[model samples]
Target chain A: MQIQSISLSDSLILTLLTLVIYQSAAWAQQKSKFIWLNPLLVTIIVLIPFLLLSKIPYANYRLSTHFLNALLEPAIVALGYPLYLQLQHIKRNWKLLVAILVLGVILVVTLSFSLTMLLIHQKEIAIALSLKSVTTPVGIIITEQLQGDSSITPFAIIIAGFAGGLLGPSWLRFLKIRSDIAAGLSIGAASHVIGSMIISKDNPYQGAYSSVALIICAVLTAFIMPLLMPILSVFFA
Target chain B: MKDIIYTVLTITLCLVLGKLINFSVSGLPASLYGMIIYCLLLQLGLVKPIKVHKTNQWAIKHMGVCFIPAAVGVINHFELIQNHGLTIIGIIFFTTFALLTFVAVLAEKYLANKSESSPSTSNC
Candidate 1:
């Protein structure tokens, strides 16, 4: 468990390996009808064991794939394309959309925060848990702001995203929630981009709403969490 | 080729602007700022859709790939996971399910009625 410095050539090889595995996972997801075959989930399932067996430290893998991580910023910015396309719908029902997302953000934060505090009773873990529903970047930022363990935030986020991607649609169907708008917003708000990405493949309209939910929820969580954390901390304290 | 270049430059420019804004204001991620700025640019006609179309599509389509590195980093926290893994997973799963049900059920009620009252807006 010594952290080792990776060579540039090794980094390049790791980066290439991630891409190859990712592309294969993506293909498998597309080819398979199973909802659980999400590309991100599959990639993680394969890479974690691969890293463990190969004796490659997670730090080395992360550094090697830093370029890909950098692309995440641009990828998030690129989400604006879908957001732009959905402008008409967003504009028409912005008030309702905002209201729902605002309430949704508050609900998720409160629920996660209280549940973690009640069960785990660890304030740092609770703080990290509170922001799990938002995108990774936003979650990380808020986790740091609240003096929580930022490392735990991403893991919680990926799990939340994985759950949302795997079971969100089917769960919605079981609940008989048929509206694409509702489905998309809930998936996006609850699961973030990963869930929305999966839903979007089935219906672009839902995807658009999902992105809208994703962005709005991110903004709202950023605003709400700081103010709300102190208040919620009182209950647990 | 030109369009691709424009797309790259435009997204990079937006990200840089976002970082600047985040530096000054703080709170939100630079990427979120970049998204807002990019969305505004598209809305204001400063940036056209076609220019960024291909790149945006590719990025969104493969956005999951970008998260691999971060997710893999979770392996580093095995000790924490081992300590509270089941509780953590339970909280996430339950809360996420509750949030989804809460939002979706309410949204369905609101949207279903809205569409019924104003069928014209229902098409989207």
Candidate 2:
């Protein structure tokens, strides 16, 4: 019979390694030449060097960390409380919220496919790219609907989230935009939950609205994408 | 201390209820359903409402800690991006512009209506 051992020693080793690598990347980030490459990117840089030297393969690393990522769904659930606090704001601004949701969905689908076909000629890639603005789950759904390759959706979603989160605040500042509602919604709409979390830190109120708007946008984007993909297919083809 | 615990308990209950509803209603987003349910609970007195004070302060202060895991995932894809640099850049550019514009216009209009309806507060 084959069995697996879940030992304290193994857990301790993993903890120590995660800490060491995490801290090293934090340190390197302080000195990295490129300003846009943040600590997340630093972790990736440190990981690449270690990934080559270590005997542990990518699958093993994923197995060790899968539990952590699994926590994300529940963490998403936890966001409900904060969102609840802003329920009053939502009710007060229902019309605006609805407008934003509808418009945001149309814009995301239209721009995503249009830009893809205009720049790149690949229809599958264009359809796959249609989901780049959405959160992963809905993005994957849209990707599947368009008959696009599923493997690339996660990468596209992650990059989209990272890009949105990273540039969101700066763009607001650059444009002299100073509305918490706008900042939070844009961040959440573009980046998903992570961007909303970042917005919550700075401004809780918009975080609440944006949190709602983010999910609404995701659902709407998913529902509309399947219909829109075929329309774009003609142009890209 | 009591409030923090209360908030935690409320949040946990909301998650469970949300997950159940999400399972039943596959079309609606789970988190949205949970948020709505939690809001109803708060409104109806089943869940005690939290006063956004000290405990919330802590949550807001330490939110960056949560981003660590997601950031790690981003690292693995650096090479794939390296080859498709232009496409990635182009997509990011257009999406960011589009998202920002859509948000700014909608929010400004919302805020304008809000201010006209009631006394304007610069609080936000």
Candidate 3:
């Protein structure tokens, strides 16, 4: 048991060490278009494989990195600062934000699930896939309620956020979609918090909007997903 | 040191307020409640944004890294990913981009039209 605890602490050190090194590398290489080298992605890539190859079960890894995970809550809660910074924008454009969120949630959930059902023909999997764009905690709850596999959720949310963060800005730029509000809303809807964080790096204004959209989309999905599941099951179940 | 302590205490207070609200309405996520409470405190001048500014900025920028543990927890579903990874990737990819495109265009158009209609209404 003592040896086990030591290894666990070692893993914690390894996780932090990896995070700091990767973050510093990303900082050093900041001018490159190295999206995959994002600190979060790098940490996951380096540490997960290391854990697996090193025979450190994810349980131990998670426990070791619990401090980092715990920080997620406070980090998220602190988002209100930026959201508050854009208070005037939110106040004036709330109607537009709400409309985008409502429409985005409905269409994204319906369109994605329909496409997934057509391709995979698995109702549970399709439902979970539909909730992929929302934040993780809310996604887990909705997945549990809808009887979808929670395991599929982390994969879905992360990949969606990564893809959205990757594609969202380029598409907006290519399409000449210059509205910060629009850019932020889309990123938040498609990518959740991670996408917002990425966009925030370049555009704090849009990042501010993204945080608002992230919250709105999450709340809307939590309420709407369960209702849609029964209807979706009719065709796909 | 002072900034860290104040920010932590303020966030804790906001979280405690979230807990209080969640007690009455159990279904709501506490993080959202905490955010709303903090936003209100800022809006009402109950808390100075500068007091929490430095720490909050760090938290927001590094928020993605904080989610890594949860994301990497996907390892538990290795077989699922191995079997259906492509499908999952494709769905998240196409659907997210499609939604992003739709919102981006629609929102830009809406904001452009609104500004043209009444520039006075928009503060920024």
Winner by lDDT: 1
User: Cα RMSD (Å) per model?
Assistant: 3.8, 6.4, 4.9
Those runs of model 3 whose alpha carbons end farther than 4 Å from true positions after fitting are A1-11, A14-18, A25-33, A114-128, A134-158, A161-184, A192-237, B116-124
Clashing pairs in 2: none
* DockQ-based CAPRI category assigned to the predicted complex of candidate 1: acceptable
Q: Write one digit per residue (lDDT tens) for candidate 3, span A35-107.
A: 5565655666777787789887777666777777667556656767765765545566668767877888889
**Per-model TM values vs. the true structure:** 0.85, 0.64, 0.78
Docking class of 2: acceptable
Clashes in model 3: which pairs? none
lDDT of 3 at A184: 78
Q: Indicate the worst ten consecutive residues by lDDT in candidate 2 chain B.
A: B115-124
Cα lDDT tens digits, model 2, A1-237, are 222444556545654565566556646654763333444445555655665586444445544554544444444444444544444456766676667767877787778778876776556666766776665545554465457744456556666666766677787788766766667667777777556655665677656656666666765675577666677667666
Candidate 3 docking quality: incorrect, acceptable, medium or high: acceptable
Q: Output DockQ, candidate 2.
A: 0.28
lDDT of 1 by residue, A44-142 (tens): 888899999998887778888889887877887886766677565566677887898889889989999998998888998898888899877667656
Share of native interface contacts present in candidate 2 = 0.25
Q: For all the predictions, what are the DockQ values?
A: 0.49, 0.28, 0.44
